[model samples]
Target: MKKIAITIIKFIGFFLGWAILSSILPLSSSENQAIWRLWAEIMPLLAIIAFTFIFWLIEKKNIKLHLFDNPVKGIALGAITGIVWLAFPVLIMYIAKIIDFDGTNSIDLFPVWVLAAFLNVIMQELLVRGYLYQMLKQKHNIVVAAAVTTALFTALHGGAFEAGVIPVLNVLTMSLLMTVVLEYSGSIIAPVIMHFLWNGIGALVLDGVSLADDYPNMLIATFTGNEILSGGICKMEGSMIVLFINVILTALFMFLKNKQGTK
Candidate 1:
């Protein structure tokens, strides 16, 4: 009973600590949109990182260590998986006339935004997949750990409970794919790159990806078909096609993990 309570407190405490840090971070009043935007982008990431490393320090784990068994291969595989899987559904959306390319828009702080995005990716990977995952797995099995962390992840991204069913499922399954990458590669490196690539490429290629509105995109696109096909107000994220792709990819990774004789 004590063990379970401690595990639960740590998980909940992580989020609370992050929120407290984020709330207290000082802000300089600036008329510059880019400066303000960049500050907003970096603050939560900074909070997450700051709070997370405290846990790492407490656990006596070095933050410099990369989690992948083979860093080089993990990088390569992560890139491929992120690019290919993302492109697949997009191709289908284009061919099926669910989306159409229009033009492009530029943002004042794109380069900095990209760096922030990378940091955001790395921070999330560490926060969820790092010690939190291992701590849970110590008390339970891998699937339980994965499921719990994935739930927290989805909630953070505004996809769980409050969102519609499809968006919730989209975030849930997408998170599972990342969790699978962590498990299969035996490191968070693969999932980190994979998440960043998906966000980076999608933000560049499509209108409603991670960096939309406040960020620049190479192509301005519009959705025309049914809401489910086009992802409606949620864009490609809520699309049925994306959900199907996620399901397929999740199954594939699970199969691979099983074949590798990894428990």
Candidate 2:
């Protein structure tokens, strides 16, 4: 109980710091490409730098840390986790009649897909899944650790941007999935990559036009149809497609975990 309390308090503090910084810090306007180049472009890098020590400190350990027994195997496992995390959600959104098309777009300034892929798969993975997740898991039960960490993850998005129960359900489910990824691999690294890729695709590549866009049948966001879907509950719920995707990928993750456990 005491350990859990400490973990919860520290978890809240870390995110409070991050959220305050992110919200108060001057950021380039999302609309301004030049501003994005100047500000948004480097924020992820800054976050990575900040998190390195912050996460290290959270674990109360030296800089060198290794959750996985094998380095090469960990990397491979992490990559596979990333692939599943990214692939399934998109597939579910598509199959459930949530998003109509592939929803890929071209931006003149950068190779949006490449950048998005890198940012989503690497940057976020490093911070949330790699650092924070590991730190929390050591102190709390897996479910608690995952939930707290993921809540921070979702909250960092400046509160539940999507409205309705669907969006909340989606985040909760994804959080558990991510937690499983981290637990199964015995490393936060794999799940972190998965997280980064998933969001990068959702924010940059898709351009806020997804299955939820057409079906607003059960979504709640103040800014629904905009290029960036903000401030409402997401539409991961009420869509059988996304649920199906989650079920399959979750099973796969578990299967791998069980295999490794028996070994």
Candidate 3:
């Protein structure tokens, strides 16, 4: 209980610090539309560095920098999981006629967009899966740790609430999936790769114009959007079908992991 409280406090401090730092950064129109644009681009990297340093200080030698014992296998499984996660939702939406590809748009600053996405996922997976979940697991069982981490993960996304109940629930389900990935893989690498792919592909499929409004991508596909099925503010990922698919996939992954362990 004390550890949980400390973790929560640390998270709150981290978020508050990030918000403050982002707010104070100066904007340059030559670079982007607004200060927030630059903030959105760079904040994840800063957060990653900050959190890593803090964790190193707190955990000392116990902090494991290596995300997995088997880097190759972990990375491969993560890639496969990411691809399946993205592909399944798109397939379901296409078949259901919830979305239609209108056309493609040009990507702007492709390299930077990819870097930002990578950093964002690395920071999230490290903090949530590598740090918080691991810390909780020290005192509590895996179920408790995963649940706490998932709840915190869901809460971190401010848009989840505005997107509606389904979106929030979808986020929770995805968080659980990520937790399972981390648990079974015994590494943060799998979840990191999976998360990056999820966000990168999602950005491409949903908005179709850019990785983000601020950062445009060379390859984009415009789609007919339905608020209910397409996720009005939440985008394609917030859809019910996508959530259902994620639940099934997560369960399958867990079952396979358990079977492998027994064998």
Candidate 4:
């Protein structure tokens, strides 16, 4: 009972900390990129970094985020993994004639968006897989940690359910995929790069990654087919095909972890 109580308390408390810190910078949805950055990317990331320091400085818990472990190798692995993550289903959909490139809407501020996206990914990985996960693992176990983080991750993206079950399932499976990838690589860097690539490239080249906001997509992709293939208004990440790919990757990584005797 006490264990369960502690788990719940810490879980809720950690999220509350994030929420409080994140709101330190007032949220905004401005036409200006600088103002948007304060809301879209910077605040959340600052919250995560601040939370990490709180653990280290005050709580004295040095979370093993596996960041900067092997810079070149991590990025290399991440690039390959990220490419594969987007390529498999995207290629299939394109080959199926559901997706076609039209043109580009180049934006001068594109680099800013990339920075925002990268920082957003970094903050999310750190918040879910960094401190909270390590805390749970130390106090409980890996399964517990994974479960809590996965649920938190899904909840954070609750907008997926607005699209329907497939998107929701995709988010769920994606959470699982990141969890497994973290175990396999023994580094958060792997999933971070993979996630950024999945979103960044998708936003740039494809229709986008089921994101709520619209940006200057480099390629004007036209999709015509069943929602199962093209993902309809939800874009590629919401595709049934993407959900399937995520499931397969999740299982494959699980197998890899088990084969290597990782818990």
Misplaced by over 4 Å in model 4 are 26-31, 57-59, 212-214
Poorest 10 consecutive residues by lDDT, candidate 2? 212-221
What is the C-alpha lDDT profile of model 4 across 1-263, one tens digit per residue? Answer: 99889768766777799888887767776878644763678888888888677765644555455666766766887899889989998899889998888777766677777777788889889988887887787778899889989988998998887888888898888988988888778778888999889878887557557443645577788778898778887778668899888988899889988998954
Task: Please give each candidate's TM-score.
Answer: 0.89, 0.66, 0.81, 0.91
Report the lDDT tens digits of candidate 2 across residue range 100-201.
443333455455434534543454555566556666656545566567667766665443454545455556566667767666766656665566555444
lDDT of 4 at 145: 87
Highest lDDT model number:
4
Task: Note each model's CA RMSD in angstroms.
Answer: 2.6, 6.7, 3.4, 2.3
Model 1: lDDT of residue 242: 89
Give the clash count for each candidate. 2, 16, 6, 0
Off by over 4 Å in 2: 1-5, 23-38, 51-55, 58-99, 102-106, 112-117, 120-123, 157-162, 201-203, 206-238
lDDT of 3 by residue, 56-124 (tens): 577774745446667887899899989988888777777877666666676555555667667767767
Model 3 spans with C-alpha error above 4 angstroms: 1-40, 63-66, 205-213, 217-228
lDDT ranking of the models: 4, 1, 3, 2
